[model samples]
Target: MITLFRSFFQSKLGIGITLAFLGLIALAFASSDVANTGTFGGVAGGETVAEVGGTSIDTAELRSTVETAYNNERSQNPDLTMTQFIEEGGLERVLDVLIQGAALVEYGEKHGIVISKRLIDSEIASDSNFAGLDGNFSEAAYASALRQIGLSDSMYRARLRQSLVANQLLAPAFIGSAFSENMAVRYAGALRETRKGKVVSLPSALFAPDKDPTKKQLDEFYASNRDRFTIPERRVIRYVEFDASSLKDIPAPTAAEIRARYERDADQYRASESRSLTQLIAPTEQGAKAILAKVRNGQSLAAAAEGTGLSPSDLETERADYAEASNAAVAKAAFEAARGKTVGPLRSPLGWHIVTVDAINSTPARSLADVRDEIVATLAEEKKREAVNQFAEDVEDGFASGSTLAEVASELGAEVKRTGPALSDGRIYNTPDSVPEILNPVLSTVAVMEEDSDPILAEVVPGEKFLIFDVAEFTSAAPPPIADVKEQVTAAWRLERGSVAAKAAADKIMKAVRGGKDLDAALRSLEKKLPPIEMVDIPRSALTANSERVPPPIALMFVMAKDTIKKLAAPLNVGWFVVQLDDIVPADTKRDDPEVATFRTNLGRGAGQEYAEQIDNAIEAEIGVTRNENAIRAVIEQLSGSGR
Candidate 1:
């Protein structure tokens, strides 16, 4: 639950909680009102879904949290539907999280654990999502993110405060958990245990009925499992594209304007000279004179400064600029010296200076005519950029004043193009490659918008190209008609029925094996042609090797007692499996082994998680939790009906 909350609320802000503190604190606050029953479709008192102490979680709050979680999940999996999410227990999970959060906050306050506003402010200020280009927190970015996620300031702050208080309450329990050495040794021994078994496969295809499903049966199956056949929502976008190239009437830079710009930057065109030098600044005049005398005696300045644990520094600057930065006397002496010549042990604000001139560079003064072409190009580019920006602003203002996208495009003398229907993932339906590159960026943006939403101006290529777009058509995610997907529905119905038959076959085989018959003999007894039985010997450690998932039959075999048989269902309606455990080899791990020490540390972390869960339950029970079952059910149904 903590992971879920953090992933949803802290996604944009990049807030994180380290594992050393409260990462193991998984709170699952199952409500005590499971038996509380009411009408299935009516709103209850004040529409409250749950109550923790004096705090009431109303339906609106519950709905918002559920929506946020659902949206966050959808960002990763576009095919997820509200019905599928609810059926997988998302609604109950979110409600449990909310109830637990409220309980923790209220319990903390009762125990004198206070969360200050300034602390919450610091958390917000440190979040990178709200930071500006300069890396400081920006109010505008913060507000915009809040609007995008549909969270208000107070709501976000309350969540942050609750998080802080919960961490304070659970820290001790999480940090203090430990596993003894003896316990660690026992766990390591278990990991080294091995099992031997015999297994048989019952493929679903062999059990499937020969006849095809009827229309009536297929319809019922499709209706019951609409989520399996439902398509994701898609939209058709209509947009107008414009860029700096679209404006053909920008005035060229005038000759007078070019001359004026040159005058404005007169220093750039003025005659100037700069020298590159290697100078060593010494703290004492005596040391400076010594280094200068060495250089004048044919020693390089760098070599002379080696005795002082320093070296000459290289610099290139105009004479006047260097004079203003250092001493005028130092600059004059350095500049007057010929290339490859050494100069003065002079004094400046920094210290005594020993200078060596490396090279001289001079720039001749230029008239206005010499820089005319350069100035004209610079001015032309600037004007074009400004005009493009102003034009986009005008279009935005026009939108704010209620102008339609067509009107804006027509007035701007640009063409408005419409795209075929496309999904939120940017794939055009029935024509994958037909979507223009210009519309690619806005496809996902416009996918969620209402048809009546104002045209959005998107800078596709920064200042170079932009698009103003709106949704032309919207098709909400839903199951296609039974007629349109009969073949798929029929295939699904057959697979489901076949899975049931396969489970029965697996059960019969297991019963026969448990009844003292050999595994091969039991397979021979079955009159139907069945898959051959296979023998296996596997070490427990091998099941977890390389972090790969253990195959179902092998995993089930390891958990069974010796000489026992169990039936296991395969995933994805593929088949069923039966395993008979034949032998068990007990592990004999030495106490001094390195793996034992590692096991102790890992097992202690698991124990810490158990401790955290206990604390969560105790806090909730002390605070007193009650939930409105009918209200929660109604909210779930409403959200499912909305097809979010």
Candidate 2:
């Protein structure tokens, strides 16, 4: 999910996504409760962030939270930053969370739910991932965690408390709404057996050649499903960067260390060995003796397995993964023999075995000279990575000595290029295909930095091939005036119209299904009869529409025990989600299929989700959430001008 945060939150403002992901959860404080701020979501100096709901959600808190989350995330993404976070929907997600949190807090208030400090503290203490394995809170670690994402303990704890209060109230309420066993069984059966008749796709060639898609047809599609084409608003930003690689006279790794690293990784540096062999396992020692005696007399291993009441395990293992002393009597004799040689009337616990080595292969062992090129490449990359950091330190010193970017650039043997208005994600300028991964982490740390001023991290951006990045120009995201997207509004209007038609049609079908019309026949009567559907075995990853190549959603479908005849809604980018529950296959663990284990896991998740959703809902219903759009816009604008 943080990976998603990285890409989606990639923005010009260094912290928009990065800091958002870090501290956004922390920001979910009762912003509505933040007092004297007069408005919600405004940025000032480092200390000047505002709040909502009379609660304070500031930059410092957000920063702390971001740091903590990133530190946790470091296990997986060791080199990710707030800039990448925002570029990847990190900021947008935060906004969504802020809205949800506000709404929940208000809802909680409305419902008279009160969360106590004790409950919140207990929760904090109990969350093992947040706490250490020592089973006691390490205050420094906790504080450090909060600080990483830019939060203070006092502020975050309150938000956490409110969140808990809301959860405590709703989980029981949602428990009553959970699916019954009968329902689950029915659902599972349907899913397991659900078959949509095979669809023979009319090739795109058919449409392309026979009937060129008319403008009218495209328009009709657009009209019928405007939601599909209405992409979210995107921004293009420009910013400057400062990174570890922008300095001069950086030190390089010594040759000795490079050699040491190569030695350390020698096992990985070497290729694997392979062998082919044939073996027979006999049910009895006498049976093995019979086979081995024949092999000694010159019978092939395969024929030996067939003739001696022994089956060849076939081109089997030359070496056991672990030594089995019982099998050692047979194997030791076998390996000691040369290839194509027969051996082993050897004794074993599983009986007797006769063996023949067919072929043995050892990968080309890399000689020092043969691997010299790769060694050089490895040593150079390591040297440069280390050197770049050292270079950054030198750049700092150079600045103290009154040197300029040009002088630093010249000294470092790095070229300079000015980037257009681009954001941290590098997507603003149609991110080139050849960008270096090292430069990807941070485009710039401080978004609102002043021009003509030397910033600490300005040279921090890694180069395109090595480590390169540019400063960003950030901007505020505001809801566009309706007039700015009149066509979009018109498209939305069309989708709304289409949705109304689809829903009405579905309602008629539902009524007919209840009135004794067969579900399939009812569907057939629609303006477009169901297309021939496909039957497929799909993995879970293939279920989404995007993975239609794997297991496409059929217009018609079915499952195991119970049955549902329901209307699926018109699909949307977000709103098009539809599920028509039908039939339930009984869960069977003994089945050879792996999906059973998957189903069991899913079942457990279903239980957890029920609890989690209830908590979310209860919070929403209990809290008081209000939006100060203007304030939020101002914050975005203000933060856009600054860098982290």
Instruction: List the candidate 1 regions with Cα displacement exceeding 4 Å.
Output: 1-46, 152-154, 211-227, 237-401, 407-419, 430-471, 527-535, 546-548
Write down the RMSD of candidate 1 (Cα, Å): 16.1
Measured by TM-score, the strongest candidate is 1
How many pairs of residues collide in each model?
0, 111
Whole-model lDDT, model 1: 0.71
lDDT per model, in order? 0.71, 0.45
Clashing pairs in 1: none
What tens-digit string does per-residue lDDT give for candidate 1 at 233-352?
Answer: 877888898875776688999878888888987977899898998877776788788878888888898777642434567988778657754668999998898999888788885577
For residues 1-644, what per-residue lDDT tens digits would candidate 2 score against the true structure?
12323443333212211222222343222111122223323454244333444544544334333333333343345234444454554444555554445555555666676665655665565555354333444343354345323355775665575555434443333221233344445445545443322222222111122223445654565555543343222223222334444443544556676677568767635765444657665655776787677677777765654412224655534244212423566666766678788777665644455667787666766755666666565555445544654554676687678876556556656665444444334344334532333444433222222244343432222221333232333343223444455566455545454556555555665677668886566656664533443333332222443734432234333331134444344344111212233433333323434444344434544554455555555554444344455544555544333332
Give each model a TM-score.
0.64, 0.38
Candidate 2 global lDDT: 0.45
Q: Which 10-residue window of candidate 2 scores lowest in summed lDDT?
A: 200-209
